[model samples]
Target: MTFYDRDQELDALRTSFESPECGFYVVYGRRRVGKTALLKEFCADRPHIYFLAAQEAEARQREKFIEKIAEHFDDRVPRIGGWDEAFDYLGEKLATEQLVLVIDEFPYLVAENDSLPSYLQSFIDEQLQNTDSMLVLCGSSISTMESDVLGHESPLYGRRTGQIDLQPFSFQQAREVIGYDIEDAIRSYAVTGGTPMYLTLFDYDLPLGENIRTQMLSPTAVLYNEPEFLLQSELRNPARYMSILEAVATGHTTPNEIAGATGIDSGPLSKYLQTLRRLRLIDRAVPVTASAKQSKRSRYRVADEFLRFWFRFVEPNRSSIEEAPKVVFDGTIEPTLPDHVAPTFEDVCEEVVWEKIRRGELAPYSEVGRWWYGEHEIDIVGLAPDDDRILLAECKWTSDPVGHSVASQLREKAPHVRWGPETREEEFALFSKSGFVDGLADDLTDDWSLIDLTEVDVCLS
Candidate 1:
């Protein structure tokens, strides 16, 4: 698939390359997030040597690394005794000529030779720092990358000239990649999230449901077992983490609720949750009005849209899906897809609000997130504490057109959000899937906005 975004990342890399001194850059992210792709794109026009490491013996990896260097330099490479010798060889070449040496999956090399980071550190301090060449260390293992390379105690600390923590695409970028209508794009994003690999699997010629059946529900498809495969590869124990994720995906958001649902004791649950959060698979959300550190009402949510969809629909009905994929999707998935897409729709609406803020259509806000207290809940809230102003919004995904009652309910819930003073300014917005009633337009003012699905798409575009 074609690369859709990463203009900022490309610009950062270009700036580093244009520098006069040597460059040591670290790039890391989760699997299938396009780290390798981005690097390949950046190196397409530059003189570079790219080596992909694997989970093999240190000697074998070193041999392969030398072979890649020989191919790039167009010379017969000498045999190296150790990683230090390997870096020494590269350092000699880099001292005279400029080249980009990228070691993809650097964690795999560290797994075999634990002192690789120390050798590289010595190489940088002793040789590469004086040259005009560049070295890029890329990895998919977030934990190893952090603890071994980017951590304070690591020998390679303070040596990197730049770093890129690459992330998945946003809703708008994903929509552009899928080339679907607004509603179908929302559903596709709910299934594929923003992962480029998954988005590429979706054939634009097919409808969303057909794509789900052929590309997701089929037992042989890549996405069918992706969540399980990722968990097993990343965690030592996948079962416990899987249970916690399932609980969160199924609406058991609070710690107590998750503990009760997963049958795990509360004592050990925090560790598991923290691990999941570090992996970027789950997020902990608190009320917009409360401090995250002090909020007791924090709720855990599955961060990846695809994982949430899989745990909610695929994991539970695997047996039935194997028997009849079409029936399962038509009967089970299709009927409840709207409900499944509602939360993601709210997320898209929030993105629209952020766009409005960026374009100066709305006032700048310090923090923007969902706000909830007791029985009152607001779908989207933007708090501008300095200006003594608040933006409250209600997002409705139902088929019926939103009426004055929805706006009235949002107004009623506004006072419960104890953010600013009683005399502070308040702005309201209502996002609807089926548009709004004609009479509701009379409520529009300088402080009030009614946004429909079309407007949401346009604002984001």
Candidate 2:
């Protein structure tokens, strides 16, 4: 069975539910990222009412809500009409103890009635204020839901005492959810992207390659067309979005580069970029020292691992994937996926470094990021904020060990980063796929740290 990875989100909601005064909570996320699951799991043992908002007219939704609300009440109320009529009676129905009323996909209800939010806000401020009830508003369309319900100027604004901007599972959290080792979990994250629903389709017992072939690559697979499904819900022109996503997936970073590769002009592309950024599927990054002048060096990339994988492999070769499943799935996409994801290994290294820091293996650093001047880029740089000292890093994904030359090359580029503070204890750290270089352990004396990703005595348990 698939597991949950949101204990903190759960605990925080429960804590809010314990409030003596009335509490309103807003939970929003992208579809299939487990917003409903997190709330349902939290409300499982509690006395709560769950109502799904459909695209039907307001009268129909009111009837369904009334039906759900009746189950939680001591006496059944047959006919229910209007938001004010339903919530006004909720105060008197459960006056003794706290209860939860979850309106799933709350955005639909508000969309059906422009006055719905003001009506609910007025009810909470007036009638519901005297009750022992928790109002749980949950939705999947994040930006719309938040603006309509959770934003500062919203009718439900400042009403929510507790909120969860529920996120997709991180790569580390995926390890627990799927019961995979660090390396294998990274592969899962790269493909399924920590979405609970998608990861549930992944078979942990199968080899990673087999799992990808069976669940992700085949024509009959659920995720084979998952991107298309999600895009249909989120975009006006999925064809254009797919084109833009493909450019990013195939390593087009800047706005100029994406437009050039797709042959789509930048003016039309900016609107699409806004939508993707709002959905959090992609991100725009600047130099760590981001400024307000709208720098031309800004870059864009697909931020989700699964989407990245889909755009890079599945979308590009959809015809080949559909026609020759085994050949393309196993012989093509499988072999090339790792090379596509090598840089994300730097992401794995970041997590590993943080774990080691928490365990006192590596000293803490304020910032860790890639650094470059013009074209040449360094894999990882950790800086001590106080002293402005930097730890230069080299990551090797091959069997070869990182050696003195890597440290030497980084030092050569160090003058370009050109720190304004005194360089303190120039520490060299190497992350190796197989092991460290010979005698480098002896060469380190005591200042350097060498980490081998393959063989570490640290127990994950």
Best by TM-score: 1
Native RMSD of candidate 2 (Å): 2.3
- C-alpha lDDT score of every prediction, in listed order: 0.91, 0.77
lDDT of 2: 0.77
Clashing pairs in 1: none
Error of 2 at 21 (Å): 2.1
Span of ten consecutive residues with least summed lDDT in model 2: 452-461
Error of 2 at 79 (Å): 2.9
Highest-scoring model, lDDT: 1
lDDT of 1 by residue, 173-232 (tens): 777788788878888999999989999999988888888998889999999999999998
Model 2 residue 279 lDDT?
A: 84
Give RMSD to native, each candidate.
1.0, 2.3
